[model samples]
Target: MLQSDRAEAAEAAAVIETQCPFCSVQCKMTVTEGGKGIPGQRRAEYKVEGVPNAASEGRVCVKGMHAHQHAVHSQRLTHPFIRSNGELVPCSWDEAFAVARQHLQGISEQHGPDANAVYGGGSLTNETAYLLGKFARVALGTRYIDYNGRFCMSAAASAGSKTFGIDRGLTFRLADIPLARCIVLAGTNIAECQPTLLPYFNQAKENGAKIIVIDPRKTATAAMADMHLPIRPGTDTILADAMLKIIMDEGFIDETFIQARTNGYDELSVYLNSLDLSQAADICGLELEQIREAALAYGEADTGMVLTARGVEQQTDGHLAVRHFLNLVLATGKIGREGCGYGAITGQGNGQGGREHGQKADQLPGYRSIESEKDRAYVASVWGVEAATLPGKGVSAYEMMELIHQGVIKSLFVMGSNPIVSNPNAGLVEEGLNKLDFLMVADMFMSETARMADLVLPVTSYMENEGTLTNLEGRVLLREAGRQAPGEARHDWMILCSMADMLGKGHYFRFHEPEEIFNELRLASKGGIADYYGISYDRLRREKGVYWPCPSPEEAGVGLLFQQSFAHPDGKALFSIMEGDPWKGVSEEYPLILTNGRVLSHYLTGVQTRRSPSLLARELENFVEIHPITAQRYRIRDGEWVEAQSEHGCFTVRARIKDQIREDTLFVPMHWGGVQNVNHATRPDLDPFCKMPGFKTSAVRIRPLHQKVYRENDSYTER
Candidate 1:
């Protein structure tokens, strides 16, 4: 309001361009680095505004605008900590590194190299993920390396690889949303989980695109759809199969595309002909007419798209569900055309790129399978190591926890992940962590998992560090930082390099910056499926972002995949037949289906999001969402405490009785921790194909708080 105030504000302002760290949309924005805090908000600093980007066209959500507050929170870890007699205390970095080296080497020497393990997270940068995988293989000489992405994206990744021979989150760009004539969403709450993406869907609807939604809960996304099929949990494949059969019976099949561009259709057609629409409808708790309408709408469209998320992927038969959906797109000639394709919306900000570089137990950089001798040799050459020295595939994420409980894995090095709140059946994960001979965690704050660690290393958050992230569209963008990390907090790669030096592998891990590590990544990824040999930091800055498979400088990047042919050697996509009973396995003793998901207020595990004062004020804690009929059956009142018990564990929380969810199902948010953490009651039954845990369809029973059993039995099965 005054001239002096305007002069002082202009004197201290410096702008920087960056992106959000919450989800896969990766909305870009500009921040005033030295600006004052919001006019009315406390502890929230820096002024933010959305900038135009391909993924998010000049729009930012509440999480993106205030994401920087957590980076400057007072509770951040400023110094490395080493556990004393019974508690963790601040210590010097050298002392902490020395203790870590001593214990890691001792464990490896006594029980062999397989005893040492490394666990990473999906939000880690490409360079950090690549180096972490190398540290596990060369520095610790261990094979136990995996990440949290296995819990979030592995099911869709497996199915995409099996069908299309490549696994990118989206085959095309986000700008093509308005060009589609029909769209189908299965088991995903896009409105709450990815609010910034709602604009594109809104534009599509305005442009005359028919939308179909399949979910047990009448989510906000479902409310906006033209048709909502209130299907039962764990029965997605049955509904998908029924649609496939309807498309065929109604003569919507593209004969030319089936003959020229696909395989195994004869077998798929045989099964589709045998599928009964009425029987499938009864099994899935849906009317036959809803299924027929959705199928015919998609079949008659000139250009169509199908997208899915954890609702279909966090099941025991998750891979089968993705396969069936991809089959629907391919059989009707919906793919490889402008505005027609299939994509799985990635939950984490870097889930797409994290899996491409490494950090998975069975994969190498560039999406190469570590099991292949040639692939191993090529990557080994890039690392200046012999192929024979590399370790083979170890195990999946949840299985690694099982090994920890079995005592096969004596020590673990965790980075950027909090399995205590993110993993399924987290009670068992906590018990296994307690059994570790030595446990180390690197995080920006004292996460739930960090509280149980023998050593805790301070690391920088994305808002305080510079790196690269591949968003859901497979666009590799150079992310910038607006402020320096507080205290002695350092980058994860820097901490890892120090550890590698202490382990006597300094030559291979000699890198002072992210670009040096990224250069090495380019060489290792040269000929692999996710080739990035030609992409450089300078190129990223000039072009904004480049898609993967940019094998040469002149080629730039390829956003549209398979315009001519599929990535398979034969240049054709493949379809597989699925046969089995589609059931959530609910019994009379545990007759209700429990589903886990995210809310609009918080993110996965709530490590950083909860620290933000404004984000926490909206949803202070988690609650059990129950239908009116189910609440009446259990004699539970609104706002009354209720206990939900499963074979895995039990959690008691306040009940919010509503009619939005199905009568046979219960919905719980996945952002909280402690006694009310929903993961405590989620099943860990993994899919046979991708090993993704069944977080969607757990058999559970509920009762009023006072009427609960006095003695709760604990059944910890290593599933």
Candidate 2:
């Protein structure tokens, strides 16, 4: 039985403990049921309380405190909907499934199985993600299966895999944060984005740890740092190279550790010799002394760590930029030890587990490549299918959308993600969606993307589901279903099962519970990098969480990876060679550099958070931040309406004048959609290695809006 089912079967406990479904921190929370007669019925009213766990210690964010509000909101989708004559009307489950199956089969018969694709979300539990990938490949017989996580941390994953031969979010635990003598936070405003993690940094600060924040603006996180390197947009690679050059100049290289722990030092040293600190400083628009001081502080520390976020990972050179940061850690030999390692802060709830368990287009479960014949044979055996029946690798998420725009992918199945608001080039994505022959979305609410679908399937929220999620620290925690799904809404796993049955693949997808699927996952990942063979739901209950690579039942999971040697075949970490050329520069027509980020009150795309009254009250609309000098140059005042135009598109938002950002840069939140969508102005240029979009930096021009367009109370008329 599932852990949630087991928990519900217990009659004594009124409050059930589960992990929060927002962000990668996975903060533990207890749901107190009120006036409960039966476990799943009796008009379940709920409240959230913080529970101590490996990721968070009894601390919940404002969003977590109110996450339950949207689950039972009046506007939540309770039944399936089918579009007829340009209007969405409630329909029966059988009719909706029939329509979906008909279109899926028709599309495949007409244009082959390659014409159909599946796009999923990072918020899905490991079991659902694994089954979704299986459904797409086996039931639909389609090769195109990818998730929204490609945009979140793929660059870091690609870099980490190439450098260390394995890609887990963090090599060490969160408890090690306070033990590090120095930490460099690159492109992450953890104070607002992941507030539950702020206490760790606070503890680190209390212990005299030096915090160096690298960002383009003086965010809430940067304000608390010992030193903030306000870098120019898209110059992360240049800044990283300059820091390495400075470290070498100060003779801070650990020769003994280098000889004992890593490889490729000679090649990296030759490349570092070609880089000039002054040139990099000029390119990054930062002072040489600032770079030197930051490098000295990090290099001089006995044990230090580097953490990258969406800022560095959303660039055209994202993979290379991440590799540059890894090079710094390798040079200082501060890895594979307590309080020292390189990590990428995963943004979504199950971004880590979702990617590890076969959601990506190019990977199988256990972080194995789909292209490997051995991996295919092993996974095929586990699924009771012939190895040759598996389809070939498909494109990334953005590439899949492009194919849809070109009429290659005739049908699409979207689950848990609202790509119309979240994907890069939002206007183009919507246009592509309109061109699809058939589009279906499964979500808890009628999201912006769901409104565009031909058929919309109502699915239960995280509170009404049971599964496991891997946090940013690689710890796997259980998420229990606290209440019954309202109305006709079903769990995503059940929905997938029903769809598989309708497609005549019920024999392969015959699991009746989530635990059944999870057991299969354990077998599939027995000998892989993200091995979860030893972890069972019962074990997870006894221990709050367990890290991966627990190969045997008697062996406890390892909190710190690569303690003795790196995962590479040679047992040595590799350093990346830095690139000298700067990223694409700004053109005269679009002189200012425009960047985007998230807000504390609003999660990605604002599909769920915006529906909550509390979160909406905190941040109702989007605004762009411009330096005082830039605002003055554009003849725009604070709260004045302005149009930011890039080569891709233009968006209008209120201007907030501040000197925190660079004079030539502007900042906008990535939450609002439609006319307020910042992604409309973002370029779709992707990293060559990981296919991550360059959402962090785009060249644009700012012009004050017409007087009539500006409204009172610091708001602008929506276009």
The C-alpha lDDT values of all candidates are 0.90, 0.89
lDDT of 1 by residue, 1-719 (tens): 46776576567676778898889998899877653522333432478899998888888899888887787788999999999998999999999999999999999999999999999998899999999999999888899999999988998999999999999998877888888899999988899888999988889999999989888988999999999988898999988899988898889989899999999999999888877789999999998998999999999999889999999999999999999999899989998888799989999989999999879999999999899999999999999999999999989988999999889999989999998888888899999999999999999999999999999999998777788899998999889766777899989999999999999999999998899999999999998999988899999989889999899778878887888899999999999797745865799999999999999878889999999988999888789999999999989999988889999999888899989999999999988888989999998888999999999999999988766344446533221
Q: lDDT at 341 for candidate 1?
A: 92
Q: What TM-score number comes out for model 1?
A: 0.97
Per-residue lDDT for 172-235 in model 2, tens only? 8999999999999999999998999998988998988999999999999999999999998788
Q: What's the TM-score of every candidate structure?
A: 0.97, 0.95
Q: On a 0 to 100 scale, what is the lDDT of residue 269 in model 2? A: 87
User: Best candidate, TM-score-wise?
Assistant: 1
RMSD of 1: 3.0
Local error of candidate 1 at residue 145 (angstroms)? 0.6
Clashes of each: 0, 0
